[model samples]
Target chain A: MTRFMDVHHGMEGITADQLAQAHQADLAIEHEENVHFEAAWADPESGTVYCLSEAPSAEAVQRIHERAGHKPDEVHPVPLQV
Target chain B: MTRFMDVHHGMEGITADQLAQAHQADLAIEHEENVHFEAAWADPESGTVYCLSEAPSAEAVQRIHERAGHKPDEVHPVPLQV
Candidate 1:
């Protein structure tokens, strides 16, 4: 499996509760794409959401986020450790 | 291979030239650990550094950063795509 890093913007002014709700809502969905959500972080001041996920491709990561009700600002593949 | 996301602080008041120098220095090193640097971003205003890498563990990623000349604030692994 490949690894992906997704950076998201447009999260400013969001409460912790709201962020939690979004995560909860996204977690409920079953994604067909080969991706696993590993970790998620939200910077309150920057309104940026950073997530690490394992997926076949960066596009798969975007698909999962779209299914989760938010759009990613940047999604890039993490090349295998050489 | 696993994927990692690293967040770094303590970059405030640093010049862009300094940041570029650090990156160049780090990129010159060869790490024994199985890790590949995917991307890096720096915010001049906020003094935050974000990086994406593929490795077997977060420590491997940190070691690479250390070899590269910076300490990370946070490091986490991305699980395999299930």
Candidate 2:
């Protein structure tokens, strides 16, 4: 499995509860695509959110995210990490 | 303390050991600025690194990162998270 860092833009003013619900939405359906979302953080002012996940492919991550209701703007492969 | 998400670019060929050393460097001096770095992940192929930290301010996070040898390209305040 490979790790992925995905970014979502234009989500300004996202609240803590909203973010948690979205994360839960992803987690609820993650197994379908074999994606495990580790964590998520948001810069409400910038309308940007970052998600860290491990999946078989970026496509899988994107699929799970899209199905969860928030599509990522960018999905980068994280092959090496500390 | 607020969580911050910092990104570092231009480190395309970083290896696992190199990444660990960089994280260690930050951890070694993080307490000086009251910054606690939670984790770091890198996309070696794209030369991008993402760092997650809790600090008094974004500046504190930046200070520790700069002292550690890899200045952040962008440091976004993470006020909302899940």
Candidate 3:
């Protein structure tokens, strides 16, 4: 699996619960791809949501987001610790 | 290896060159830890630098940042693709 980090904008003034709903979308993505959401967070001030996921391809991750409803500003691959 | 994504404030209005300097610092950390910097990016408007690193510990990544001159606002672990 490959790790990817995606950042999204336009989430300002959004509540954590709303964020949780977004995360639920992520969870759905995780399930569909058989990937894992290692970590996810959103900055209310910046309206940026950062999510780390393990998947086969960056496109696969994006597909998950597309299915969810939000489009990402950027997605970059990551190297794992172990 | 663990993948960690750190978000930092005070990066708004920061230049990509400055962010690259920070990435150089990250590279130094990767060297020290014998890890890899899979991907990294910064938003000039938001001043957020997101880095994905493969390291042994979260503290090790933080240590890299401390050595570099900027501290991370948050670090969350990520799973590997393969």
Worst lDDT run of 10 residues, candidate 1 chain A, spans A73-82
TM-score of chain A of each: 0.81, 0.97, 0.86
C-alpha DockQ for predicted model 1: 0.07
Candidate 2 displacement at residue A48 in angstroms: 1.3
How much DockQ does model 3 earn? Answer: 0.08
Please tell me how candidate 3 rates in CAPRI terms: incorrect
Model 2 Cα lDDT, one tens digit per residue, A1-82: 9999999999999999999999999999999988999989999999999999999999999999998999999999978766
Give the winner by DockQ: 2
Clashing pairs in 1: B26-B68
Better of 1 and 3 by lDDT: 3
Best by TM-score: 2
Lowest lDDT 10-residue stretch of candidate 2 chain A: A73-82
Tens digits of per-residue lDDT, candidate 2, B13-71, equal 99999999999999999999999998888998889999999999999999999988989
**What is the per-residue lDDT of model 1 for residues A46-66, given as tens digits with 9 covering 90 to 100?**
566776677877777787788
| Model 1 RMSD in angstroms | 10.0
User: What tens digits encode model 3's per-residue C-alpha lDDT throughout B1-82?
Assistant: 6666666766767665676777777786568766666666565554556777778877888888877898888876544221
When summed lDDT is taken over every stretch of 10 residues in candidate 3 chain A, the lowest stretch is: A73-82
Q: Which candidate is the best by lDDT?
A: 2
